[model samples]
Target chain A: MDIFSFVNFFLLPGVVQGSIYALGAIGITLIYAIMRYGHFAHGDLATFGAFTALFVAGLLGLSPYAALPVAVVVAALLAIAIDWLFYAHLRRMPKIITTIASFGVALMLRSVVQIIWGVDTTSYTRGISRPENWFGIRVKPHELVTLLVVIGLVIALHLFLTRNKWGKAMRAMSDNPDLALLSGIDNNKVIAMTWVIAGGLCAASGFFLGLNTELRSLMGWNILLPTFAAAILGGVGRIEGAIVGGLVVGVTEELSVLVIPSEYKMLSSFAILLVVLLLRPTGLFRGKIL
Target chain B: MDWLSFTIYPVYLMIFMCIYGCLAIGLNIQWGYAGLFNAGLAGFFAVGAYTSAILTTSEAAGRLGGFDLPFPFGLAGAMIVSGLIAWPVGKICLRFRSDYLAIVTIGVAEAIRLVAKTEDWLTNSARGITGVPRPLGDLPYAQAQLAYLAIVGLILIVVYLLIERQAHAPWGRMMRAIRDNERAAVAMGKNVPVRRLEAFMLGSALMGLAGGLYVHLARTITPDAIDPMLVTFLVWIMVILGGSGNNRGVLLGAVIVWIIWSASEIVTDQLPAEFALKAKYGRMFLIGLLLQIVLRFRPEGLLPEKLRRAPLSEGALSPTGHGARIQAPHKEI
Candidate 1:
């Protein structure tokens, strides 16, 4: 393929989609690091956040972008509530129970979305969005916005983790919970803060996905496996790794249609996941093994 | 409902209960005894279902099947095929903790579903494979249903007896020992990874048996018919609520949860057209809530696993710790 065709059709769209996946993977990585288990419901949490933005945008007659802040806050609170109500009691239990409980939460969250919005595909606004051409490449306004927001969020997160007290505490807890606790870090507060950051990012990812494509009830569930593959492939607990992993997975999947049938696009992410597991279980960045 | 119709409904429900009972029993072996979290219950079930369907179904023009095997042979093939699928997955994943297994299993199930969707020559794609003859197909409708129920019930009984025997066997004790404390079990010369793989494969084989029975009962196999999340989660809830380690409790759980699931659908379907769809989702919401509640309050489930005490030889109890490990029941659940 020529450079223009590759850049416009495959590369640009891949990066746009990659940004969304990166946003979701960031949350998955955070939860995996801080909570010490795979939060299966993270995908649905994104769906909920996106729909929450959609709902508010409808109520206020505002653009979806305008409603982003409210959606982020609401989603973060919902995350905290879910943790307190469902996962807190299972703290002493095995990691598997919490993981299973997260699956239940996924079901509940998706059903709630279905019940509220019905099953039809909906979007932020009703109209075709044409991409503006820049020299040889074309990009949609919303896609550009998604990419910008993701970059901004990642930079902010990097600063927070490196400079902020609570962020450092999160890293410490992730490294060694017992030792972190012994060192006077408030475990509960760190956990709550982890959910806040993860939940907000999850909302942004879901919102961006809705912006880039249309929103459907099953969208989150469908993308969930790939998002997880990105997280694991990047190395579970590493922030920078999630971004690189997401981009690689997204770009590779988009490019894979050249070799394989389009219907089997999803299988690539899984193939990458298995290959990574077999070759290097610690992932590219050497994050947590589990 | 009339007497015959009412009678048939219960029989239908009972047949499903038996099928799911087989599933729960299998899960109990894996999660309950071995502490392996297998989230892909439907994948194994599908392998069994498709394997049996291919083996027993009549000739079709474009598809791969028409082996025209006997029902017993089909069922056995189902178990073996599912076990084979599990073998490599267990080999790779058993080395890690349960969390990794859960993720890999989910991926495997999704991949299997995708394969079934895309592989037209194998599964006939969306058209699916039809004309798979049910056992005793010549009998009257009610009679056929009852006969199939009997067959499934018989299978359930045989599986129950076998698994129950194994649970109380020396091997079963060793499994629980390994699950309760892997390090201690290893110190006592237990090959933890291999034994765990065996448990995973065996449990998957039973799940396959359930799938074979299911396809035979339905008389058709389609990708959509097996709703992965619904079936897998239902089986998980059944085993968890009934008591993971206890075989009898697992069976009771299967019946109770299946009844609730089906009954809710019947009730929800009665709602007006506008509300009916929402009510359907409401049922799902309730089921999910049910899992959280069950996990919170009744973590051991309705029927907790019973502890057993078996005598050990003098040399066998060398570590003195071996006796404590033996007597220390599997309390992790």
Candidate 2:
């Protein structure tokens, strides 16, 4: 097998997974900036979105694609609700305390999903179809869509963060909460907007993931660690960090199977996180300007 | 009394409450008092449990496996070995700030869990060593649990009291100083890193002791037996809810939270099969909701450690001092 061709088999899958990961990482990084702790629940939130999409698909009798937008909206609203009730109150607590609370929130949300959806894995009927040949390398429809979605979302998020006033306010709050408050930004509204945007994005990514692979309640728990690893690797509080870090993780993990057993793919991502932390805890690409 | 004869489970549950309670107190020392975040507590606890189970079980060591060391020695060995493993981790971990340490510690924990699942030579892999001869085989499983509970309970009480003493001592004061503001404490000539290491190591050692006891009581060890995030997060909830710097508060938080979290599981067991299974998760969601609410409402904890206001006499400032380091005026939740 050609090294590049063989690499494609793995690399193509990585991009799809990486895109899904990037979506989740963006939400995670956003949460870290606004909330100031790793949102352990992001994975579950993604799972929740996928589950919600599945629920909508079955209930409305819509195809997965048709129901996708609805699912995303519902999931985004649920994210808002969870934040409104749980996370919003934790702003004053110590960062670690809030983080621990967030873990509790994640656990609770996952448990709720387990209770509501049951543990059975569900997926779209059509799922991602066959791979299309691209330059002697084959990629699937969902994979292609995944790449497209990632690009679109990143561009969309970049526009939101840089161009939009709400995005600027969110960025300002993250940069200096006290200053933002003193400057007369409504912290609560900014916080809610942050939740709304992040939640919406999380839903979209989650739906894409469900499209790519099957959805299970444990899926959220499984990726929770990696989502965190990506966020940490990407400097925990930067969107660009999220994008770059996620791709690096995606490719590194895909490349890892060349040497290590595929069962340990996640370990590769974790290994990257450890090395990053030890060598440059601040992250590889560090600059104040996003 | 006759009508409530199934009261044994409550007793059993109470014992469980104690085991987790001990673990929570160990957490309190590290996270609450010292500001260390240990996400892999479940891993270390599992290590202790497997160590004790293997040392005592005939399946593990065979006839030669019978060091036949008394339970106390077995317990000591369990603690020693687990702490020995934790020592290097703590050393490496203590070199960093809280967040980085937390990320690495969680990874360490995840790695250990997988190792426990895959390490057939040590953990018997998934087949898990069965037929673990109970220390008191004559007693029924239920009765044995109570016995273990009593023993562990006494040990927990002792540990609590000891920590209580330490919390008031000058040494505890120094730890509090370090946790409240690391840079300030360092400016005062405290060895911040060393102080953090001591707290982290001591906490891990106690956690190991709890693990040894947990395995002995359960009489078996499995990879699934320990969930690292649950262990760490649950302890954090307990400590934070009880007031981070307060030993007494942790005890209360641990028992209350354990009972509440499990009560839902017990209730779920009675639920109409499908929904009941789901109820267990309901409890999890509620906990997350609760932690957020609890921290928001009472960041000081349900029974937060009171600010140390009692005067610290100069001569009384030793490790064995009566003041419990918490007596310093420094405030923390």
Candidate 3:
């Protein structure tokens, strides 16, 4: 392939992959902003959402596209339930408590999946290969589907965040929980809503990711680092930053095949993360802080 | 392979848990007492295991051209390797906020595991190093295991007592100050970085020691054998459940958790095939549920790290233990 084709090929996958990663990273950044401490369980949460979508689609005999909307709904509900179960009472606890609790929640979720589905990895859609031919690239139908969904979600999210009352409320709470609460934001209601939005986005990201590749109960946990790196690199607590950082990391990792072995794909992400963390503590584009 | 045979193994495993208890207690000193998280405990453990594997079982001088060094020297080398790694990680990672630091440490852990897994030059590829003989393996089987257990148990006891004593000493006080409030300690002229580094190195070295003990029992080592989730998370649970800073509670925590872990693996094999899967997950679910509930109900932990108090007459505990009150006010970074 010529340089144009190679770069385009690279950018296409990078952008598509980055968008899903960005979606997941946004949830992490938002959680970090309000909850404090890393949410180790997030990758699994995405996996759970995707697995839920896979199950619902199989049960209802719906196509991948049709199953996606229902999956989003289920994921939102699940997020709300998880938050209520684990994070609701944790508001009063110290920071580390929530971090540890998230780990617990993560482990429990993965174990439930393992017990129910068996350790063997499963996928949302089966057999017939996703045909290549989108934008002169060898991208598949599922890849295109993932890309379109991500772009739509990102745009919708940006508008909701900028123009909506609840968006401002969410931003305020992230900025300063105490100030937001004092300014008449219902901490409980806002937090529940945060979970809903994050949950929806997480489901969409998970489904799209599953579309691109096969889904395993553990896939989400595996890719969590790049997602977090993107979020942190983009500047924690900023949705745009997550999007940008995700693309950067995805591209860097995929492109690293030039020098490093393919099996060491994760190392590139780790390298980006370590370099980002060491050089820029608050991220390259740190957003407004309290 | 008779599944029932594993039942006889728990008593021996319980003794192993005691070794883990010692490591967790050391971790509690760093994370619980000093608020410095080391997610790379598995890496340190692997380092120790590989150290001994290369030393004790060198019939095949493969990669790194095996020295076949004595076991004692191998253990020392493991401690030194861990301490050396800890110093640099502690320096770079310690500067970030706790959240950032934790994530980075996790990344570092995976990196270390990956290196061992992929680089045959270091750990002899995925085939792993084998034929490791325990210390006194030439003795009778039961007697040798018991001897190994006894010798390791003694080391754990000494390490435990030392940690307990040091936790009350002046240096321990400085660590607590940094944990509770970094700026205040810095203002009081505590070499904050050095002190944190010291705590990290000590904790990591102990973790390496636990790894060494583990290899001696199993008599073989594989890079893939290290489970970051099972090994590191269990340690985190142990320290958190025991109360981050309390040595006594950590031992209890390890014993309780590991007993449950081993018992689950042993007992599940006897179950009817239908219920086997659930039995396997039952253990994982319990740990996760326990961690969440404990954090919610007792945020300080099962036994919160209680500060060693002085007379209230002297105002809040301060530098110089005598009447010197020094609270360094902060200038934000």
On lDDT, the candidate that comes out on top is 1
TM per candidate, chain B: 0.92, 0.86, 0.87
- Positional deviation of B76 in candidate 3, in angstroms? 1.4
lDDT at residue A143 of model 3 (Cα atoms): 72
Please give, for residues B1-333, the per-residue lDDT of candidate 3 as tens digits: 454345436548865886688679758867866777676688888877777677666667566635767677767777777777778778877776666656777777778888788888777878877777677878866666667777788888888889889988998888878876688898999998788888888888888788777887788788778777778888888877766777887787888788778877878879998788787777888888888776666545565656556558563554543222111111112
Give the candidate number with the greatest TM-score.
1
Best first by lDDT, ranked: 1, 3, 2
Worst 10 residues of 3 chain A by lDDT: A90-99
Each prediction's DockQ against the real complex: 0.54, 0.38, 0.43
lDDT of 2 by residue, A1-290 (tens): 68668756777777777777778888888877876666667777788888888888899899877777887788778877877777676554455655565577777767777887888877888534766777787877777777886798789879988999989999998888889999999988887887777787777777887788788887876776666667767776888888788877878878898898766766887788767766776775562211
- TM-score-better candidate, 1 vs 3: 1
Q: Predictions ranked by TM-score, top down?
A: 1, 3, 2
Best first by DockQ, ranked: 1, 3, 2
RMSD of 3: 4.2
Docking class of 3: acceptable
Q: Candidate 1's C-alpha lDDT?
A: 0.88
Q: Write the per-residue lDDT of candidate 1 for residues A36-139, one digit (tens) a residue.
A: 78898988999999999999999999989999999999999999999999999887666678888999999999999999998999999888888898997898
TM-score of 3: 0.92
